[model samples]
Target: MVSTRTPGFSRPRGRFTGRTRTPAPTSAGPSSRPDRPRLGLISRDVPRQRRENTFPPTPDRLNPAHLASLRSVQLLGCAIAAGWAAAFPIISDLPNQRLWGAVAAPAYALAGLLCLILPRRFAARSAAAVGLLGAVLVPLALLALQGRHQSEVMVVERSAHLLLTTGSPYLQHPVVVTDYDPYLPAMTLFGMPRQLLGNGDALTRVAGDARIWFALTFLACLLASWRLLRPSRDRAPLLPLAVLTASPLIALALAVGGVDLPLIGVCCLAMALAERDRTVGAGLVLALACTLKWTAWPALPVAVLLLWRLYGRRPAARTGLIAVGVSLAVILPSALTRADALREQVVRFPLGLTAIRTPAGSPLPGKVLAGFGPTGHTVSLALMTMGGIGVAIWLLARPPVSAIAAADLLAAGLAIAFMLAPAGRFGYLALPVVLVIWPRMAARRWSGKPPVPPGPVGRRPRPERPEPALPRG
Candidate 1:
């Protein structure tokens, strides 16, 4: 042993006498093998930092060309809307004001030029802000002008007054305007607060300025829609916001003080709520919208579909019931008070034997078809009905998987209705178009990663199991 055995090897005794064994390694004072290179502090820390789940990775920025295009389109919309709104009051108020309508064209062109000269990076936000400001200011300015011109606002004001005093808004014809109180009873509610505060002063009554109220409401709706529909981690909501805020039809509708804005607002809010899984709230709001006008009726079926998809058949049926109850609660009082008159005015007037005329700048295919007389009108109506039915069937066949999809389908249904309507304003199509397009654009931009599908409401996701460790050599 002294002459030949290795230090770590031992000769076996007794039963193991025939074999020699090597001793196992003892304490690891240092690696017995050759010295290995050490990782520096930066290299060690970097991987450790990545392993920690404290921070999320940064999102990619939008493309420069896409951003620029978005900004340009937004600016153009804002400029046009602002110019149209500014010109509307002048043209409508002054005796020979139609001449001033031409002034808006040049003003819009100049605004567009100015917007183009600004830095491209900030252009969309700047333009959107400008448009939003214009939307607010233009209506306020019109209200302040106190033009005393005959408008839908006057109809609402007078109807509200008549409802309070004469017990029937349809009994007396409003001053100079003669469509016979086609508005729903809930519409009078909006005008009542201001009229009731007037204390019977004629000037105060006429100055109720429902247009201002409607414009403010519409603005709020646009903001809410933008917030609800905007994609996570994206900053390009400006274009969609601008498109809605700066629409010429929307501007015109606001300028004219039409009652359509409230309907649009309520419908939009309902859709937003439904998207957020607030089924009961959405149902209540949708009911409120239905109380305002017939415009929201087409959305009801879509709402049902959304509820069914989100919460099964029972909840969907319950929501529909709630909606119907709310609508009846609002509508029944007026209907009971003046059943025949309300029916004739609200229903007969809108869909009577008389031929309906399209709005002045209507671009509906129906408008073109209407030029061919009775047969054309019939064809237009039939086509519109068929188209609407087709869309409904399509929706039923392929139910939407998300709130955004539901909205798109609902908007599509509304668009079909607007296009087919025997009489409709171009503005009627604006909300639907924006609702359909904005979400799509946002989705397209933020689709770099596949979205994590949401779990059913109130349920937690299953946790993933840890992987088995790899064997070391």
Candidate 2:
């Protein structure tokens, strides 16, 4: 990188050789001219300064060695992920006795190893592309290959079939049964693909729908990563993209049927848009994501606060109001139809609490916090408070990142709270948490001032040798 600090600001070399002047000191004593200070107004007629001609060419995006190293690193990560997915038969098993764990195994392995080995610049771009493609293709493949194997994926298919074939909304009512989970409603909208396909088992249709959703979400994540990393201005966590893409939890969400992928994609979109100064868009995205899964609500506050920080309080307030107004316009209809049902599912059922059990049947952190109870509306409230504190401190120490990190960290904390709560479902939320840390763990390309190399102990900078004046000709 070229030095940002320009030279010749301190002293001119041979530029002033042809034109020079001497200043006389101000008169003192009896003839003192105090009003006219002896400040130098020296003039120089020299026009051919050497410093003016010095212009280093712009550097290439990345050196060949760097790119090669990144590729190797990514290759190794894929290998390890593949090995783990293959060797660990316990976790990699598919829902219906099918096992395509082998495919994911390599993809994840490559991701992990590349994260460790590749340089930040190359890794960020590569991981973004790979992660996005892997997220989309892997899920599609699983859904296509293993239809009706998983219960939720089956539910999604059945829901679509009931809607399409029977022309009945009752199928939608089944999703109401799990109102505590709003993702089903969002999934319902994409039944167009299933409508095209003739009567197949509910399993096949849902799988198809799911595959598309996963693909879309993956594409969103990929786009976000690319947009965030392309300019490479500030320090962004590249590893986060890898983690977001390659986490086993994400794979599990795809293998089974869950809202994690969609929520993740929306969250990413919101953050990216916010960074680009599209607060209204970010707010709408966050609002839509929250509708899919209440877990995304934390992002709302974070986004608002970030807007406030980025653009003064008044503008931030306006943005927040607009976002809320738009979100309600979109979500209010669905929520209204099932107002009583939603109340029973979300509020009365203590959907407000985090007593949900993990896959292994352990109480998530949110559950424990929920035990604190009535004082806080839900575990999200408590977790949000804690996460908010940490975020506030971080922002105070250093300004908030385009609000993306704030949203991400909130998600990570929420995931942890869910895991620690009495009934945390590790399957769906774990991936978001894992993804939140990816950028922090991975190195990013630096585009600021060039770094200073370590000098010998206690040694000072040596004086630059002055060039000898050319012989008079």
Candidate 3:
């Protein structure tokens, strides 16, 4: 330079002499600096671009081994369900029992074989198709062939007729030959459309069978539950979905036309909605379920606990009030019109000393207690109540953190209640047990994560995080 330095430059001095001179600002703006480079938006995004491409997208298809195992289980379940439906004719006093068995056994066997051999997607669809056909056709065929209907269906149909004719479903029917309508007024309402058009003939009643309604509704619930419980990481939850949809108990319920299927379906839907945080919808559906039967009662407390954990006490209380209000709205008119009848038939009769006598052959605690007479009934009732209460407490104390967990907790509670119940059906445990266990089995085969070790109840799990790297010298 003439002085070899710009106006504000300073040369290094003393021990810093080996270092370059410090640069200073000239008349030129900061951009004129030679040592500094400007970073544009594109340059700044380079690291982020690399991060975005660091890992490949997760696979959409399930592991083949897992799929095979799941398919095997599904085929086995479908075979059992089909066999059960087909054998119904032989087991019961129905016309063409052997013929029906012959037809149904082969159809189900062929469907199961098809599912076993087809590709996974097609297999799932075929299994679902077979299940739907079985649910609808088997029950209708039974209704056509059998002389007597399931006791609950008979009672419901009779109640609907009574409601249409005399405006009091709770009143005993003269011609329908049912002992009593043990269901809530809501059930009679469900049967009214068909009853109104019918001349009270078995054919017309069968045409608008309440079991069909229950079966269809149950299928809808399965679809909704499958959608909700689907894992975020997995694209296809085919295995669990098939297990749930084609459950033998569900098929049996559809065939027999039991009132429990509708209640179970509603309860499952409510749980799914609640898990999705659709509080209002959940409350309304839960209220509707409560109106159908007492089997859904335990879900009320569980729903409340879930809402309380997710939204806090106030919202939970409000949702609870909404559920109670809806239930009262649906039930009160009938309650007011026939308080004595409703109380005696819906409440007292089900809990009556003789209720367990119908299923005396069952191996449950209640069934076993039936042989001991009134004292045993009383003890069974107390134990059942205590068991239900204990399960409720356990759920409230720890509250499930996810939908699957909620289903498991709810299923456990219902199972305990049913097992100890004075008049519980073993069939009542089927859907709940399946909902609780199927996912666990599927998860063990499909999930890549390590299994969580069992911990004490009410303990919150801590998340594991990686340690920070130390700076190098």
Candidate 4:
């Protein structure tokens, strides 16, 4: 060895040869390792890679001025909605007057400011709870203002009395008992809850009953919001929840006992159940929603989509079964008790009415758009119907099983289209429509990564070959 050749050079190592031999890698399968290097941030202990992925190339995560602008817009909407709600109180003849109107305006303004200042830092559930608490106390405040003897429920008492005592739901004259409207029977049946509460003056009893229903509606919406906003076990971020809960339109809707509140809860529950593969539960919740309001029928496509996804391509039969069951559950008892009454009230009443007035026209953007034409209701409804059909098709065409984001978009879009409906009552339209849309809009904004390019199904990515080990010298 000392003669010149090195120890290993003297004789080739095991499995190697001196005559231009090439080495093979020891491992057969591809390396189970990431292609990229990880970079970590020292001070914060936060991984730089995740932070970079979430934030765009822009220097600021969220521009403070942009957030302030959003807040300002929301405050303006709150003011307008509060003013509208205060100036004209429909549903019940209760008057809000300027004092309560002022209360709502400032309350909403402050609430909106809070939302603005916090950005993504705010606890939305807590804020929504606070808002709901304020809404519940509104009735008590109104009771105190109007005196216990003069309640909003009492306003409708005379009409309620005629139905309760004589099996009729309406009065022929101010207080005269008559069977002019058959629909009164069903209304009478539903109104029984109020009658059971107490025997007070007509206005007091009627107002009290309405108040109770309204309160229940408010509570339902509040709870629904809380549930929707709760942190999921997956630890997925909830930007959608924040956007929805913080929306000014939703806040305004909660200010009054808006009918859409219960509908929102029902729809949310239905979607949640459907997402969990609880078909029957979803159907029943949707049916309950239908009984509360006819507008809930718009969610039929979503229900059908869920059914199809659960049962595969041959889903029509299953969907039909669910539909028949839910329909029977919702309509059977009501039809039996008040078939004639419903016909008279819903059908004949519209024919008899010479005018359809909004009390005051709706403040929502949809109303404004429809107002361009004389037959706003027809036009608005047409647009909504068309949009709904389109959305249904799209949703069904590509049913998402694990992706809540896709499902939420479909539901929320439908809700917005409904608000754009020309005939929607102001109390009914604005809030629910906005809540659904806000989440989707925010999600689109927050998702920093670009959408993935579509690839052929089942195509496997090819491995990149390693560079030839530089020819050893």
lDDT by residue (348-393, candidate 1, tens digit) is 5544224333224456776667667778878878887898889979
Better of 3 and 4 by TM-score: 3
lDDT of 2 by residue, 315-354 (tens): 5676577767766775566566656544444444434433
| Per-residue error (Å), model 1, residue 90 | 13
For model 4, the stretches where C-alpha displacement exceeds 4 angstroms are 1-94, 97-99, 109-136, 143-193, 199-208, 211-231, 234-256, 310-323, 333-340, 347-360, 363-422, 431-473
Candidate 3, residue 138: how far the Cα is off, in Å: 4.4
Model 1 residue 282 lDDT?
72
lDDT of 3 at 58: 21
Candidate 3, residues 1-473, lDDT tens digits: the string is 13434343343221111123333323345665664323211133345434222222123244433544477766876678677757766665644334445445655676788788999778866766666555546545665445344677767877888777877788742233256566887788567656655636666656676666666666566556655644333355554555454455654555655567767667767766775677788888889888888777777877777777766887678768889999999889888888877876787666654232343245778767745878988888889888877887888678865555666778888888777777776677875865565444433323322233222212222323323434444
* Residue-level error in angstroms, candidate 4, position 117: 9.2
Best-fitting candidate, scored by lDDT: 3
Stretches of candidate 1 above 4 Å error?
A: 1-107, 132-136, 148-150, 172-177, 199-207, 226-243, 355-363, 438-450, 453-473
lDDT of 4 by residue, 196-292 (tens): 6554765555445544454365445434433442222223334434334334344434333333555565555555555455566556665665555
Model 2 collision count: 32
Q: Model 3: which ten-residue window has the lowest total lDDT?
A: 12-21
Q: Candidate 2, residue 159: CA error in Å?
A: 5.2
Give candidate 4's whole-model lDDT.
0.45
Better of 1 and 3 by lDDT: 3
RMSD in Å for model 2: 13.0
What are the runs in model 2 whose C-alpha is more than 4 Å off?
1-76, 91-98, 106-146, 156-181, 184-187, 196-207, 232-249, 346-399, 429-473
